[model samples]
Target: AATEAALKDVGPIDLLVNNAACTKLQPFLEVTADQFDLLFNVNVKAVLHVSQMVAGGMKTRGSGGSIVNVSSQASQRALRDHTVYCSTKGALDMLTKVMALELGPHQIRVNSVNPTVVMTKMGRLGWSDPEKAQTMKSRIPLGRFAEEEDVVNSILFLLSEKSSMINGVALPVDGGHLAC
Candidate 1:
């Protein structure tokens, strides 16, 4: 209902960013049924729901739009204590591909930005332990994690006409972590 109300007021939406995400750091064996459901509900289901709603509008408008789902590097590689979170993102990446394939006829491009751990205040606080931070950073060729701007800039590029031909790509904003 809230989504419908927002769409009604926004007119035709030419851009949609399904940045839905939720995570609880737990080992795979310890992740409870309730936790898995919560993560999937927020991370995967919400994206599907929103994309369907927005794509319907784009198709109706007869003008192609772009959708950028904010995925994570964890989607491409397994990370410790992120079993369920990684699963959610992996599903999101595949969802982006299928959405692109189906929506291409309408010129609606769908892509994702898979960012490394971004250094927001929460990120910094969470990774404040030097030993843990270094362990993660050492894996990246750039020897660092991404800044918030790094991830934001990638999203902007994908959404802009500059990347008009790019679709169904899971562009990594990780500092070469995945490359390594």
Candidate 2:
């Protein structure tokens, strides 16, 4: 019902960002089914549900819009203790591409932003140890983690007309981490 009610009596939603996610740092052997379900519900399923509803509106309104799904670098690489987390993002990335393929004709662009690590509070938890942090940073040619603005700017670019031709791509904002 919330999805149905979104932007009702307000206006058409020209832009949508599906960024909700949850993660538990546990190895696959130690991860519980409940934890797996929770992450999938929020990260993968929620994005699908919300996007379907919003895109339905956008499709009917006949105006092209942009939808950005915030993914993670773990989607492409296996990170220790991130089995469920990585799986969720991997699923999300593919979902973004499929949505793009179907929505492109309607001028609705769908994309995913896969970032290395933004210095958010939660992001700092695992990498708080200098040695551990440096280990990851060293892999990135830029030798750093992403800032909030770095991600925000990328999303903004994807949403704007500047990226009108861009669609169905998982743009990595990984400071070259993925490249290395």
Candidate 3:
């Protein structure tokens, strides 16, 4: 329980960021049980583990804090071959809401930041093909995929006091991709 130990060592954690994820881009039939478990273990279970560990401290300390999970637009929009990935992120989105509801009384805010295609290493592999990239961009109202800065801004906002009153929300920083 490294997560719990870390919380105990720190005495009280003011923030938690559940950013782990795994994806196997294959057709539904090709996804094995092991692949499915791997995705859920990292994307869903890890979030629960870390949040539960830190949230208790924030509650007992009586000082409010923020918990931001990095979800994906796949939670709302389907991709061609991301069945397991999408499901795990969707689960994280729901968990953020439930955690927020449970922890609100203790002044622990739980929320999520969802981003569409970004220009990271992973995004390059997923969108480097010009035709595919264009098709993907077409679905976004902003007419472009997200940049790293776009996702960072969303996370920073959730962490800052500026979002103090905002809780249990899933903010999509997807360049309007979900709007389509």
lDDT of 1 by residue, 94-180 (tens): 999999999999999999999888887656766788998999999999998898889888999999999999999999999898997
TM-score of each predicted structure versus truth: 0.95, 0.95, 0.93
Q: Candidate 3 — which residues are off by over 4 angstroms?
A: 5-11
TM-score of 2: 0.95
Clashes found in each candidate (C-alpha, N, C closer than 3 A)? 0, 0, 0
The C-alpha lDDT values of all candidates are 0.91, 0.92, 0.88
Which regions in candidate 2 have their CA more than 4 angstroms from the true location?
6-10
Give the candidate number with the greatest lDDT.
2
Return model 2's CA RMSD, one decimal.
1.3
Clashes of 3: 0
What TM-score, to 2 decimals, does candidate 3 have?
A: 0.93
Per-residue alpha-carbon lDDT of model 2 for 1-180, expressed as tens digits? 765676465578899988787788898789999999999999999999989988988999999899999999999989989999999999999999999999999999999999997898768886798988888899999989999899999999999999999999999999988886
Q: Candidate 3 overall Cα lDDT vs. reference? A: 0.88
